[model samples]
Target: MSSAKRILLTTISASPRENVNYQFNNQVAIASQAPVALIKLLPIHELPDKVIILCTQKLYDEQYETVRNLLLEYYDQILCNTLNQRPDVTEVRIPDGRTVEELWQILEAVLHSIPHNCELTLDVTHGYRSFPFLYFTAALFLKALRGVQIKAVYYAMLESEETEKPIIDLSLLLDMVEWFYATRIFHHTGQASPLCELLRPLETPPAGVTGKDNAPYQLVKSIRRALENVSAAYAQALPLELGREAEQLLRRITQPIPRHMEQKVPLATELFGSISSFAGSFALPATRQRRIRIKEVELNLSELTRQSSIIDSYLKQGYVNYALGMIREWMVSCAMWNQMAEESIYRVDWWIGHKRFETEHKFAVLARTAYKADGNTTRDIITPEQRWLASKWQFFSDKRNQLAHHGFRYEYVLHSPQQIDEIRAQWEELKSFVSSKPHWNLEIKRGQGTLLLSPLGLSKGLLFSALHHIRPDEVFVVTSEESAISIEEITNRADWSGRKYVYKMKEPFTGFAEAKTISRELQNYILKSDRIIANITGGTTAMQYVIQQVTQDLRLTGIETEIIAIVDRRTPAEQVETPYVPGEIIYIEGQGRLNPPPND
Candidate 1:
């Protein structure tokens, strides 16, 4: 809300030619409504009134005086005749930008010189390797620590002499960094607030985007609005609507690798795809079909395990707040799990804010209702285990409530081994409760029905796509030693923690002979499996051919098998419209469904 971005901050470096010469040619009017000539002069219109040149000691001692003389001469001849008065330029000295700490110190000095409540327009055009990064970090720090708003970040790519250099705003790139962190938060806690914050900026189109190909701008606004709807759906306890909206947003907002310089936003696209996938696939236990329920439990258990692992990492690294947040989230999830039979699994709004039940009281009420809901009045419904669980839940509920309402005071907070044990007990209890379902145990259990054989090459998207859609009993990744390591990492990070079913072909399966040898081993595994699915999306030509041939041979021998491939159509000629980036998972029968797929 602090709108007075009066000062433009730029770094002085070796090449000061562009610093003085580069006008914002082909520039559009900024959102700030500064004059075109003024914008061309400073390049960052948000910093409308003044410019501040932050010079390191090295630059000032070596090249600052010369640059000042050149700037003064340019001002005297060209700028003086055209403008009313010379632009207010001031030089501030700082430490050398040699080390990260030194650059940070310089950044601190620069930030301290600015007023606390003013907006910032940072020009990262000319700086050393770490200078641009330091500025970005400083901008974030100032925003968090000092309540400063970063209006825009301008960079003039002064590479070619002939091509006109318009000032490009990289603010969205910086927001992508925040988006990445927000994504991690969402994955950890399943909260929509971080995602809402991410989309808030797109309420208005970015500066200078208009005319015919307004798809990006319109799509961004639509996605932002859809995310707002998702947040509302979360509040209203409508997971189905939330998932549907998120799916719609994914289709609307997704963009391919752009042809124009102005069209590229790789980070935003990646973050959007990740979050949208998470939200779209999310389901409430009561609303989902049997198969979807199995998948929901699978994804939930994996996410819980990953969150616990991250908590351990945080505690090891002495990140108390992060650990506390994770544990508190776990506690809330456990409490919610107790009330899951009431069909309240999707109602996050109840736990967060229910008009009738306050936070602390709600947990106690939920505990009683959950334990006593079974129609056995003669006998005490609450077992010894349930009693113990309820007691621990009360303790966690109190602590969690305190932490949420009050603040984190490490000295006064609880971190005993007993507390840890209770949290782990709750996690195990929830896991057991969910895993009691027949389908949940069936798909997650080792050596079950479906077997998906994927030849691992480069792209891991196909493997992930297969894993998400088809809950395969075991995933056999056929690749060399090096690629096996990479694939394992991908699978692990995808929340398949401690899963031993993802097997790598021990034999060298690169050639026809070696592939045949591996196929024999795969035959045994497939014979045990109820149904077989061959993902012919990744791997070398020889490897894919071997899989197709091997599976086909098995089918002839009366084995049930299906071959599938993932294709991401980027060109218009491929289809009427693309869905979910990777297009769609389609059945591949002979050559009809085998359009050439992207290489890994």
Candidate 2:
């Protein structure tokens, strides 16, 4: 077979808006040269069969179209001028968008259109957001093209002030790619190995062989042996000098053969060894072998506790780190909210003094310290409040922890009913408080008292008092009972003097007659007076009749009257005070005096 290779080259054109496009262009050209030189330096290279060139579509619109056209125009001239040989090339276009899904779809479409055997080259210097896409695409490509050799070129642009040359280390990147490929290969090939059979007992053992049988015991040993071999081989292939370290790790892991081996040979041997010693010392039936087996199983469990403790410590440390991370996230979320709500204008000194932001910074230190304390096992350290707060910040932290440590999958973390209720209550309280209307000096009183007359037009009666702050020139009194106090008596008693009085008959009248009477009475009385008082607090009909009469009179004559509602005092031998105290009413000099309560 010809030792031919496939190569992919990518170049990113800098935008005109970029601060140093000239420098970027030179860097890209240099980066482009270095990869081609590296490929030529490879020992077993017949020239590459297929080459793919990747570039941003944005570059085509902004800068590279002219360059591309020039290259096509002077293709032979460029080849003669340049040191490196140019290979057959296919251009792959990367789309522009803020969303990963959009970019992913565009990339997927582009890759789908390309021939299956071709390798991918990514140019990712423009923006950091492209890194995830590039990594994911490369990983996927490696998975799809299993046997194909892949190479990566990383470019770091240098500043003029820096004399140190920019270095691109492709070793780690290449190692990662190779590891992914190897893992895929191992996963596929491992399916056919005896290791797969060892794993099978973990899923489903043979029908006759109960879990207590020697079959499971044997399977554990077999699995441990296979895992050790694979791990040793993998370590031997590692490029690192610490193959001894890898072997040590494999040895340590292999020391604990999982107690549940398919065949119970080790367990049976231990049990029989113990029983044989006791055979001379004690009397026991042959049928008691099952009892001895049970005893052996119990002994295995006691030993497992030691192994489980090691696993638990690791798990606990992981949980602690997880919890601390959640706490840090929550603190960030709260700080962001506080900043947004307060416009970052206020509370700077408070935030600095209290160190709310600084507290979150300590998470890194605390996480590391806790991890170390828990024997580098995050699962062992329990960050109780941190985990709780993490759940508060994002409901997934606790659920994620359980899955990580406990291997639980089905249960999901969600807001508890109590948490929901508390949140709802707080929201309702805030809504009510924010939306409530302001109440001015308006006051409502509920009591029986004498109506006192004040310059503010307050009436102090035997049972109640009212302040008619709005005054009228003429007084209208419409009462059903003639025995009730007259308008003159009320006005005189309340010291409402010089106010005109108009009386109407208690009976209803014809429309025009009623209208004329109302007009004539209001015009005659109000034209000469300064205030009009209407009292209508009694039985329902009496109040209604008085209201209608006063309303018609005022509407016809355009007189604004101060109406006082009055209810009669029914209790006897007990003096009823007005609801309003005399001191509560302020009277101007010319305004009438508000009568005080009668001294008993």
Candidate 3:
């Protein structure tokens, strides 16, 4: 019944097969000739490569010899074997599964009987009461933990001598169970790859599978990329587009599946509610979204409240490390917002413009000071409730640093985790305090328009074409020393004249941390909610990646940002009538339209 190298697992039944006649496809295996009806299901006179017989002491003592003789007689006579080669059968001893301990022993025996990650075929035709359940449970364990693939599970029904019994393939039931776990994982972690794989088979109908059977696969395929994008947003800790991305996934799943589909497809349809629920968890209110669309969101109260909701989600889902770092950084951001609120505009302007690093270092120091100091020393920059939140940051700050520098935190004598109720109360209080605070969002004057951030790569034509197409008022360039040989060629162009330019020179190589550090600095030059375009079409692979991530983060910092990679063509062509057509501009972050080059 099994293919080469596939293990067939079955058990010996004490029931009298002597009176039974199992017939299928003009092949019959009588109870007198065969130990089990499983022999009848073999594919056209073929023996299994390996057979694992689940045996118990009482069962073995009574039926072992009879079963052995019947199998040999059937294989020798019916199979017409001349070489005398038999299936490599192994009888493994197991408990009878009467008590709890015996059931555990039976489960362990089933696991020990198989090779790791092997292809398996199971026959439950002659199992005892708990035997089938125990074996099936073991199969699920092997699948989830050991990467084993269960090829088939079959049960042969016995009814009458003249009747042909049906062999029910229960493999579909097992697949549904796996899909259940995968869907739950997607719910908890926002990861969709597992469910995506299970649904991949349904993408195109199998040979015999057609019509409504393909509905779930089509539904999943449409949203597969969106699902992964939402997962990536969560995994990367970028909340700027998380709500929108989650909504996209939710919308796609809400698309109606064909009615009365198969079992596996229904499981996906049933998951629509959970998808909507989890996606709603990351949603921002219309007011906040509108405020985001306008100016003055940077270091803003509403945006911080939105982030707290995401942190709340992580906490509820038991992602402490993710919530931990985000919580402490929230404190730094709150302190900067506080500083901007308390200090004058001139001081803020001078601090941020002349000493950018010093400005960031000062805000970090102020946050720490505000956290440690409870008196009037920080009252100018931090409110009393804000100080309390800052104190909460104190706890996460240590935990975050400890996680980064050391391993797990060891709890010694007189150490215990905070009470669950106490933690919940603190989080609720923090959320309430952050939500009630006023926003110190700054407004930009007119004429402060678009800013273009592009990496300096080879091909001045590419950058120049982008400038005219994007038509930004200011430009921020990240150029490697090697690419700067012809830097002046693009810098001195009359087409790009009347715009201010600032260049960052670095080694040809840029690491992730380095790129992230530099990307954050762009926030200074960013006007209030100004349109920022990150042209990643030019730069190293590392630059392209981190810039997208940082620009997404920039959106959370109260600026409008989009990531686009421009290319001449997907497939290169030799002759182009328009060399500076600017090719294709693909938006990586949010929706954006490609502009045609400017005219006289």
Candidate 4:
């Protein structure tokens, strides 16, 4: 029993263009081959049982009246005349095409009208510029949020220059979006499974590139092999083996393609490029060998994420020894590298500073001292809860060291599962503690503190407000290459102690791809942070968007993060009569606050 009902959704246009007139004059046969265009273009099996027209009041009454009459005529006389009934034609009222809020409302109304078990077909034949985009996004939203199956999305190809009227299937765009997401999964996990699944989609490349001898076709096949090799390398933690295969694959990618096939390939080129960029990092030197003191020579955010992901894969597959060592190394790096920068001063003695710290324990002690001295009181910086977490991490480190130096004992290898599980659980708790809000003290000041400012949009308010809320130990101002001057000035003007480090983004943080890249650049700083407070009030929309996403991603890994937009509200007349009362500060936590403080 097929429960699918076909519903056609389209907007009515006010303009009396050639395509509109052509559509109206010929209700049954817009083309010579078929009597009815909608019936001919849409798959016969998926033809609409109901037609929905979205139109503004002005267009519905004046312009859409003619189109509606034509549809009604076709339905009553041509489509269902022999059946003795007319197909349902629903006219959904929409606001005049101007605001995005109006567009959202229109989408909601269309969604509300849709039946539970139905297949959707959208028509972009005659509509405004934003119509197709809005409708497409709505379809995606529905598919994700409501489990709606989008059978097809259509846009009739009728440019003024083109003589033939053809229907263009827009469903392929959504498929490409899915492919991008799949590739992103592969990039993040370094697992060949997701990329291998993409082969099914690439078998039918966009623009009909079905040539077996095509360079892109061959490239994708080669990439599948490369992914397999890289996956194996990750499984074994053999960087050399991965680098050998990756560099060879990269060589094949950069090698001159056939002149004829270059222009024909669109989707394949993008897929290959993304894969190449992700794979290129595997060729880099080991994290241990990389310079921690030199800012530019450090392992980037993406590399760290990949390394962490690789460790997770090892743990999942029961590579307990390898996972433990990697975890210990990363934890040490997080501590010592954090001490390398002044703004990130937390544990190391600010007075004594970093002195080629050989052991992770010494680094921890120094970090503790810095945190203790951050305030006026001589009280311990770490809470008892935090001390417990530290103790657990130390235990994990001890076990890792025993395995490394004394070789694997019976207990280490025999009861590995229980030990690994404990280590993993404690590692998560330690990470949460390290990045939790409790480790970070909130400093209230009028101006000046350690600021992680992004000066993309040339705004100083965010920096000032952020400093006022939390007076950091050191400031790290981040800026795009384009806005480096602006961030430099802010860094110089601010009366923060010690060196002012400015990190530059290679590109604009506008899209998902760019955001991922930007997130990598800010990883170290974010990990060192007790809290990630994203000031979306400043910077370009892209910059603000990526920061919010990065912070959210951090929160997923048990880190505390917040998004704050500074609001400059004028005091009300009645309030202005009284003495000055500053803006009220609000605090919210993932866990509810304790009703009564625990007696220590």
Q: What residue pairs clash in candidate 4, if any at all?
A: 28-35, 301-520, 343-474, 347-366, 347-367, 347-368, 348-366, 348-367, 450-474
Span of 10 residues, lowest total lDDT, candidate 3 = 438-447
Q: Could you tell me the TM-score of candidate 3?
A: 0.58
**Clashes within 3 Å, all models in order:** 1, 55, 0, 9
lDDT of 2 by residue, 43-141 (tens): 333334444445567655664554444333333444576675555555556656458786776567545544544444433333435654564565456
Tens-digit lDDT track of model 1 for 1-600: 344646667765564442223445454322111122234455323334456677777777876666555444444565555654555666788776677788778877877777776677888877676778878888888776776777778876556564444566789877767777777765445456766665555444556767756564566666667666655654443443444555555555555523331243446556666765655454232332534212233224544454455455444444444555556555445444443454444543433433213323433433543344354431333344445545555555655555565556555655566766665555455445543332111111113456778777655555666655565656676775666766665565344432334335445344666655665555435534566778887767766777777776555444557888876555643322321234357887532222232332
Model 1: weakest 10-residue lDDT segment is 438-447
Ranking by TM-score: 3, 1, 4, 2
The parts of candidate 1 lying over 4 Å away from their true place are 1-3, 13-23, 27-48, 61-86, 99-101, 125-127, 147-172, 189-194, 197-222, 229-265, 285-421, 433-600
Highest TM-score: give the candidate number. Answer: 3
lDDT of 4 by residue, 348-385 (tens): 33212132234343334434333443444323444554
Candidate 3 deviation (Cα RMSD): 17.5
The parts of candidate 3 lying over 4 Å away from their true place are 1-4, 19-35, 44-47, 76-85, 159-162, 207-218, 258-261, 283-306, 328-399, 404-416, 419-425, 438-600
Quick one: how many clashes does candidate 2 have?
55
Evaluate model 1: give its lDDT. Answer: 0.55
> How do the residues 376-452 of candidate 3 rate in per-residue lDDT, one tens digit apiece?
43334455554554466555565656655446556422212464345556667656555344321112221346777
